[model samples]
Target: MPVVIPAAELGEFVTALLNTKIPDPDHARTVSDVLLWAARRGVDSHGVARVPRYLELLDSGEANATPELSFSGGPSGVTVLDADRAPGPIALTAAADEAVRRAQAVGIGAVGVRRTVHTGAIGYYTSRIASQGLVGIAFVAGMPNMSYPGVTGAAVATSPLSIAVPTAGSSPVLLDMATAGIALGKIAQYRNAGKTLPEGVAATADGTPTTDPALAKMPLPLGGAKGAGMSLVFELITSVLVGAPIVSSFHSDDPQGRVHRQNALILALDPAAFGDPAAFTEHVSETLAALQGLPSTGEIRYPGQNSAAIASKRAAEGIPVGPKVWGELEVAAEKLGVAVPVTPGG
Candidate 1:
């Protein structure tokens, strides 16, 4: 069973919980908004369901609640953010904002963020950039939770990438994806639902393919070697470039090498810089119209179209949260002395 709660109430609850752990009110609000956005957009695996894990990390000192973030300018249009182990949403929001600013000034802008925690949905950050009428591309690297193709056990991070193109409509054309066949968070969702893992998406502790969520230890790549290779490249360009390399450090023999850190690269390109902004919008609208008009057996939807619809529906009705996630939220609320929102008819 799932409990339905109004979006406003959910956001308030999440913000309160995060405030208990995060000293900075702004950071807490940013994280709360990102989490709620994911939930409303139907990406439950990366949504409020992650609050428990975030709390655990904060309690264990793996994630910083009040980080001293610093920003430095590199070459032209390049900026680097030292998050100092801040939560991913805070760092990512800062980086995305900076990227958009720099892109407005110059033709293009790139921002790199280092020493952050788990970034929820990559699309949220990119969508912010696209909302500014600029092209946005984002990549993130974290500790390994997926296996390399033809390899055993966890050898690489799922390594998500996202691109958002400004469109004529409010919603941008967003493409957010992980290199892995499935996200590790989705695996947790499956376990919470008492459901089996999808075939070829995960492996057992010993490397054999498994459908049992409890027995699954690692996710497989999206396209075997190709996906694994892209993950490697993302790790190199983001983490390695930012000097917070996780892939090599995770495999190092040093026991202290393992750390809870993530790195991200965000790029923004202004359509006005290339040509006329109106022309760009016209082209995008026409292309999308043609694609949508194509004959198909079923409805042909764009990348973010379905998510936008889901968000609208969830906002009007309430966010439907699974029982397991609701229980976790209740536990957190109790521990933090925050009152849980009342669900309708309950």
Candidate 2:
């Protein structure tokens, strides 16, 4: 069974850990926000559950607390960022800002990023760009996971793709999805619990299908051939285009034999390029309203709607954490000796 923790306590504990271990305030803030938002949005796998790995990587020198980010502006509204081997939050934000700037200038901005760490939560970046009154689309890649297109075994990264549009009169539509049948994080959670997974979702190391979490190593594509095709195309948009430092050695060198760290591509567009921003947003709002109005045969959920609703409820109540993760955070807090926040981050 999973554990449950109060939200405020978790946030405070995480803040103390990040501030204690990572000296950079912005990096700490960004990481904290991502973790907190994950919990608030009910994505437990990504919430405080990630802290142990973050600390492990930080201690192991795989992720640096402070990485200097720099950029080169190019023709055709392009920006190339050298992450200087920094953590993802810093690099991703810098890229999003640059994309917004270029889009503002040219009605569109596209950036290719290299040498960054795990950015965590691609929606965070796209939503940031969208909030600035621009339409944004993004793709990010981690080390390779699963096989490619009936290939069964490893071929390319999981290839997560995201698109966010600025709504003039309503909330922007943000669609961020993994080509995998389910999030790899979900598999990890199941494995931790020694549970079985939903059928047809994963394969073993040998690439045969398996529902037993213990035997599962990778998730299959969501819709088989269609899923594989989308992931294949995403690889072209993310890793290859950005020059994935992938070598035969890169795979073996990584613990998972996929992502050594993280790689990403960000594309931003100004709605002004298409037409009036207000009008565009109004149309989106109307369409979404109509869709939501349709009678749900079951528990119908919109892409980002659940997150917004959960945030509202959790804010009034508290963020819930599993007991295992809370215990881990407690130990880290004791080590750092920093006061945890009075309220959890949610």
Candidate 3:
């Protein structure tokens, strides 16, 4: 069974739980905000269900609870951020803000982040940039757990990319995707729901494709070689460029090579730098409208269209939490001495 929780209450609960590990209230709130943003938009795979795993990371010293983040190489529009193993939301949010600031001044901004942990939903950072009326692009590279085509086993990370463009209407045009055919989070979600994995999307420990969620160990690349190549390129531009180099390090014999860490690149482009900013947004809205007006048997939606609708619906009706995730939250809250939010009728 699932429980329904008000978005506000869930956010507060998650924040409190996170604060137990990360004493900084602001950092905790940032992580909770990003997670809740995904949940409200119906991306439950990247939502609050991840809190338990994050707690494990913080507890095991895999992620720094309070990192001393620093920035360098920023005389121009490009900058490098050393996160000191900070949690993903904190590092990426700071990078997004810096990108926006630089873009406002120089028409374009690019920030490379190093030594961060799992970046949940890269779209959050891009959407943050888009909210400032700037076009945003972001990429994340992490430890490899996805399969490469014709490879014997897992060979690439399911690195994600996101782009967001401001529109005249409320929701921005957002595209958030991983290079893998399916995300590990989605596989976990299916396993929790007792559902089978989609055929050809995931593989077993031996790199053989499997439709059973429980048997799936890794996600296959999205378009065979195409996705694996994109993931490799993302790693090169983000991790290698940032001097983190997660892929090569993970495959090396260095004792600490397998340490979990991620890197990211965030870029922001100001439309005013090109032409009339207002006209650009208006044209984007017109383009979306034109696409939606096309004849079809079903609704024609752009990338962020259904997400906006789902956010509105979830905002009013409350977010649904599965039994497994709720139980994990309960255990964490109890351990942290935080009170769990009550469901309407649990």
Candidate 4:
């Protein structure tokens, strides 16, 4: 069972825990906000569930707490950021801000980030850009944790992609997804819950598909070759472009190489640069209306719509933390000498 805690309390608790390692208060808050944003929207796999793993990385010196991030301007509307092993949210937020700023100056802007840690919920960064009235796109690549379509072992990173488009309404249309059939964090969630994985989603060490969570070694691509191909292209655009290719550098042979290194690319476009902003918003709203009006057996909600609704509801009620996640949080809090947020019933 999961326990419910106020969203604000959860955020405060997470920020305090992160502050223990991350010296910069703003950086710690940014990381905590990103994780809690995912949790509030029901993306539990990318949410506070990752706190324990992040703590491990920080304690082991695999992830830098206060990295001196550097940025250099490229061609018009282009920028590259050297994360210097900083946490993903910190690097990503900086890149997104720069992208939005450049987009405001020009018609479009792109930012590349290299040598960052695990980028939790790429949508969070994109949606932030969208909230600033710009179209946002983001992609991230890391060390291989997923198998290539027909390969035996892990070959490529899951490689997530996210896009967000602003609309007249409060919520933006956002699409955030991984190339793998299931995210690595979701696999960990399944293992924690003692549940069997869905068939065809993962394979055992011997290269055979397995439903047993314990036996699952690597995740399969979403649509076999199609998803694998997208992941490869993402790696090229992100890692290779940023001069930090993860797949080529890290493999099972080099376990430590997989610790805390990733690359990301973000783009922002202003609708006003192309045409009238009002026209773009009207078109998007009409398209969404048309899609909703289409014949359907169930609810027809666009991407990010349900997530927005979930976030709102959870904000009013409370964020749900599963027993396993709560237990891990407790252990982390105790180790760091921080107090955990108290649940309603407990």
Candidate 5:
């Protein structure tokens, strides 16, 4: 049976396990916080289940436990961050902070990050910027794992983007999505639970569409060509612009070309830079209220509306961990000599 663990306890366990691998407390804390943020919001695909895989990355030296991040080009509201293969959460969080700082100084701030590991839930970083009353936008380009419309095999990254706009008297309005019809994480989750995937979402290694989770090797683009085009544009803007192309490198013949890496672009726009920040948030709230009042067959929810509600409920009721993920966490705890949290009635 699955278990429900308190948010605080889960966070502590994840942090402890991560600390055993990552020497820097701040980096570990950022990663744990982002993962928990996703879980609390009911985005289980990018949640704590990723811990075991992240540990593997750290263990294999694919992710630098302690990264020496470098920054350049602060003038003109633009910056580039070289993460030195730091875990995504650590590098993206730092990029968001830098973007916010620059936005506060000028009207806008943009930061491009290069050579980071899997960026878990890009919305977490954008939401951080929204918390400060600024509009946030982020895009990530990574290795090829999604099929393009005309390509046979995996031909493009399931690149993701997120936008967050602060609102008055409520949670921020957020939109987080990937170019693929379904994320690769979702396929892994389905396979772990022995569930079949919906047709057209995924394909086998040979590009044959498959509903069997075990055989599904890659996700298809969201709207086929539209999604593939977006993924390509994202790669050009983020990876190519940053001088670290991932998709191209992954398909290259270079011995080390297939090494896992990702690049991202984070931008922050201060409401105060254009008009009164308070008025802007108030208007945003009004717009959401109008959207909620619209006629619908079911509950009308904006992008992040349901997620905020889920987070509140999980905070009080505890987050649910599937049996498979719980077992994995238990194994990691034992390996690290860290105490696992006892789930209620477990």
Candidate 6:
């Protein structure tokens, strides 16, 4: 079904399609950026693959393209944002900026976002905040997804935690990972690609293991009990702390999107908050160099290493999106009265 269009055509096609359902041009652009960046990087799971679902959510009332967000002050270092059922990325843009600023003042900043739809990669925010030469850590907690090891049905959400530090290299040691072995986003990506997942990524509803993508009824916690325990703690700091609450009942994703909430705790610590900034940077660099200098069993990756390389390669060659996704993108573009892409670059 892939209608091969060039990259430019694809972008225009996607832009036009989003514009049709989402009247907010700015939010549409933000969504575009998130999708594009995911593809440009190596995360095919979170990349442009989600366009169809996003469009469907917009066509329905599940995800409101235009939402009026409100912000209120809490603790001096805390800000609570009520998304009023808006897209997650749009609401986060402002909240992230405010958190970094608070970090500038009190050596830490925290923002809680509630009543928003799915937010993309956690690393995106931490990386942005780290460019200010501060150590940035983000905790993204959501609703119940996977179950406790050896249990069935949904029990816990795949709470993701990410961290980033500033460095001169093209890619910093940015680490973004879910507490689970695999994330819900990645499962959806596999479904879209019509491919089976690997064993250990997920399990069937009966607690038995399966690699069938269609049987991915639950997300498995990473490192077993340890990951599950961390997710619970983050759920408290994120959703529970914000007063929105987190449980299996609150977690529902249908064509008619439910009233979901998100909590993001961004902590920024200035190097000066501890000791000399230069010394800290030098120490980190030395450690990284030592790690890289060691003989590698395979590839010595320092977090975010894979993504930076993927982005560089995609920028040069072109992103390798599924042919089916490409076809639908073209069809959507044609429907929107936009030009089709000649290649995937657009």
Q: In angstroms, how far off is 273's CA in candidate 3?
A: 0.5
Cα lDDT tens digits, model 1, 10-100, are: 9999999999999888889999999999999999998999889889988999889889989986877998999989889999999999999
Clashes of each: 0, 13, 0, 0, 0, 13
Runs in model 5 with CA error above 4 Å?
none
Q: Give a tens-digit lDDT track for model 6, residues 210-293.
A: 777787888788888988899988888877777777663455554322345566676777776788877887788788888989
What TM-score, computed on C-alpha atoms, does each candidate reach? 0.98, 0.89, 0.98, 0.96, 0.98, 0.88
Query: Model 2, stretches more than 4 Å misplaced?
Result: 1-9, 150-152, 168-170, 245-259, 295-300, 340-346
Model 1, residue 332: distance off in Å is 1.3
User: What pairs collide in candidate 5?
Assistant: none
Runs in model 1 deviating more than 4 A are none
Model 4, global lDDT: 0.90
Q: What digit string (tens of lDDT, one per residue) describes model 4 on residues 188-259?
A: 889988999998898876658888888888888899999899999999999999887788777647656666
Q: State, as a TM-score between 0 and 1, how close model 5 is to the true structure.
A: 0.98
lDDT per model vs. reference = 0.91, 0.75, 0.93, 0.90, 0.94, 0.74
Candidate 1 vs 4: which has more lDDT: 1
Pairs in clash, predicted candidate 3: none
